[model samples]
Target: MLNSAYLCGMQKYKVHGALTAVGMIYGVNYSIAKEVMPHYIQPFGFTLLRVGAATFLFWCYHFIHGGESIDIKKNLPRLLLCAVLGVSANQLFFLAGLNLTSPINAALIMTVTPVLVLLSSALLLKERVTAKKALGIGLGLSGAVLLVLQQGESTAQGGMLGDILIFLNASSYGLYLVLVRPLMQRYKAATIVKWIFLFGFFMVLPFGWEEFSSTSWQTIPPLIWLAIIYVVVFTTFVAYMLNAWTLRYVNSSVVGIYIYLQPIFASFTAVLLQQDQLTPQKLLFSLLIFSGVYLVSRK
Candidate 1:
């Protein structure tokens, strides 16, 4: 009984720990990935690199750990859909949007994900949404709108477009969380992600190939190379794996509420790197975002 209890406690710690780590990695990723886009590599090119490299890594890991074959016929269509929403659309929109917007703005905009997830769950998974969750959704939406309004007109077109794309990315991701949950029960996280990346590679290929080919690799500096490596390895490979594993232990909305922590880490990193500022308005908006996610996540 003691051993079983100890294992259960440890398992809980690991699951939550993995989720926290994913948030931190992704928070830092916003700044790191922003530094590489539209200069050293275009968004599409960078996304291709991210998805392609991650696919290779996932496959390599799967091979090393005693190769397991999935029920291809049964799971292929769902896996392909997962690839489109989770890998292709998610990465492509995020990188493209991050390129056009400030890392802080991008991070703040992502705070709507939990709200989106809750709504998606309610609609698709037949999950319940309490009055508190509805209030939370309203709060999150207000925060996103306020953040957009906070931006000056100097870069309105680009910033607005970027914000919209980020919202789309969040929507795709939110729905993905709901859609992928069923598969989580039937397969290992690695198994699901490996196939997702494989299909994602093809889905993104047509869109990203030209930009990827146009990149002048030899002119790139070491720091940019390091950033690129971080995006592919940590942001793409490790983060997805952690999220997939966490889903096996919790609801998709529970997994998504962790996005509330992202802007804190993102702003801190951006400030440290002199990439963005920490203003009072941003703080107030972030509070609303935090409050909303907190309400939505309450049991």
Candidate 2:
């Protein structure tokens, strides 16, 4: 017999911890992953390693505590679509973009995801929208423009093309967030996790195979090996699992707000390490995006 207050307390802790952990991982991942690409491995190859390893881990988790089977007839098609947008396209564009662009830019661009999801909900789910949410979306998109325009000003060196790809990646993932919601009500996160990675595994293999094959493992340093493991295990595997766990305790709006912290972690860490430089232009645009996300994410 638990009281409502106690349960509420526990949920708040769980929700906050989960969202913070997720933000830190994504924020740090941008830099860590950047270290590995072009130098040790290409973008597609690195993505292959990430999705492949994650897929295997998900299946292993399923084996230990697998739940009832998913409904194949009605859900398989939906799952496939989710795989394409959520896992395959999302991972592909992101890695490709990150390889070409600076990590700070990538992190800042990701802040728009909530705005994208909100708009999609309004259009696709026919959810009612208010003025605040609309302004938030506008501000969020506008901030991205500000950041894009300031590309060369900061120490970040990626080209305009990279930023464009990352924007596309964010768009794909935002759509995934919208589409996966209904399916989430129908299935356990564990069950869906396995399928999403498996489908993504196949989708990425062809594109990644050549680059993955060309890479020579012998040349990679121990530090890079550790980074690879981090991407495979922590960023891809644990992050996703934690996100699913956190969703059980908090609403999606709360989850969206946590995303705002990612750029903070990413930019601070990158600047501290001297891997990236901070500029006034970035700060100005970051303010716009953060304010936008805040407005959009507010109830």
Candidate 3:
């Protein structure tokens, strides 16, 4: 028989490894999304492809793993909301925003989602937000503003409409995160994802059909297809699973802190692959945001 002490130690190690893998997966997701955005598909088309492909892959995995199927009759309301918030609206707004704004600008706006979540949780869920939490959120917001200011020239060139769309995306995503947790606790992540995708696919179908009919499918290259697959499988499917798994093990506060890393990873990847320059301002703002998140999480 295995010793209790050895089993506990093994479990602890597994949790840590999972958290690390989650972070890395999230980082790669941002990098891959940024890389693939401009190559083969327009943002709206890309979003549709991503949701469709991921929906298929996730369900296939679910069936293969013998996961329980979602009961539509029992969970219709929750499923509908998840589909609207998490899948259709989130993807649609984010892609539309990207078309209007620079990726860096979009990433900077997304950094505020944790703060939004904290506030929403307090208002809607009655979760306690201590003074320290408020301070941390404030600091994080300041850092985000700095990061955006650092990219002022690009933002100005991108125009105001895109910036507004990006902000909407950020707000919608924050609401989705806060609201989805309870449902996640009650349902299997895979089941939640499958239904969300099904709903999202239908939601986007009318619009997607128009775009689909207009495109010449044969002219697209193999590399473009590969990029779409990467975005669909890794970014959407695997990333969501890792995120759901990590949330089960870690506090939401900790998860909020880790999300700040997305922009930093995106910025670095942009510099390395796309030859985008990183200004001193971005570095400073990033530090400020990290410091804020650290402060908020500290007991």
Candidate 4:
């Protein structure tokens, strides 16, 4: 019995570690990705770049590891749906929104994803939202809101339309988490993501091809190119892989709740980079966010 408990604890620790890694990757990506879009590349063009490169990487990873092939006949339809929700629509709206909004606004708005996931899980997966989980989500959200607001008027940099698109992105992602949870149980993460990105590539090609073709690729600086690579490799490929793998060990709600950590990671990065200073107010908000994460993560 003691051995079994120890194994279970270690498994949970690994799952949380993966989720935290994803949070850090995505937290940094908000600024890195935002810096490249709408100037060097339009949102759709950037989406194409991100999805296309990620699709290639996922397939290459699958081949290198000898991952099993998916059942196209039975799973293709579901994979297509996931492509729409998880990849194409999700990425499109996010980049577009980020182009129109400030990075802080984008990160803060994304914190609402856990609430959407909690509600979706109850309605679709029929998963019960215990009172503890609900409270945790509420506290996390409050902290995120306070943090964003305290940043002063600059928080609304992108305006109402951008904010609305960010909300839509969050909604799509939350639903994708619930829907994709079952697929994680049935297939290897690489097999599923590779197929999803393949479908997503075709989906975004129509909207992005013209923008992609028109870009003056020669004018883009090397640093911006590096940012693009980071978005494609770390945020799109590695983060997605980690999120999908973690879902196999925990419920979708637990996966969603980890998003609350993103803003905290983002803030800490700013402090480390000397872009922002740490203050008591920021510390209080961090406490609230961490407390919420703890409550929801309780076994």
Tens-place lDDT digits, model 1, residues 1-299: 01112335578678767877998899899878878989899999889999999999999999899556689899888888888999899988998898888776777678788878987888888876678867876776676556545644233445888988898899899989989988876788999999999999999999899999999999999999999999889998899999998788777887887787676677678678775677899788778866876675555
Those runs of model 2 whose alpha carbons end farther than 4 Å from true positions after fitting are 1-7, 130-157, 247-254, 274-299
- Per-residue lDDT, model 3, residue 239, is 71
Reference-based TM-score of each model: 0.86, 0.83, 0.83, 0.95
The TM-score measured for candidate 3 stands at 0.83
Q: Which regions in candidate 1 have their CA more than 4 angstroms from the true location? A: 1-8, 131-158, 275-299
Largest lDDT belongs to which candidate? 4
**Which candidate do you rate higher for TM-score, 3 or 4?**
4
Model 2 per-residue lDDT tens digits across residues 173-292:
778766766666567777877888899999999999999999999999999999999999988998877766554443344455556667656766767888567888778877886787
Query: Worst lDDT window (10 residues) for model 3?
Result: 1-10
What C-alpha lDDT, on a 0 to 100 scale, does residue 183 get in candidate 3?
A: 61
lDDT of each: 0.81, 0.76, 0.68, 0.86
Global CA lDDT of candidate 1, please?
0.81
The TM-score ranking, best first, is 4, 1, 2, 3
Instruction: Say which candidate scores most in TM-score.
Output: 4
Clashing pairs in 1: none
Could you give candidate 3's per-residue lDDT for residues 1-299 as a string of tens digits?
Answer: 11112324566456445544554555555556655554456677777777888889888978898777556788788678867877888887877677666666776677777777777777876667778777777777787666655644465666478778877876776776667666666667776777778888889776666655566667777776776677777768987776555444444454555556666666677678865679887888788777876665455
Q: Give stretches of model 4 more than 4 Å off.
A: 1-7, 154-156
Clashing pairs in 3: none
lDDT of 1 at 180: 90
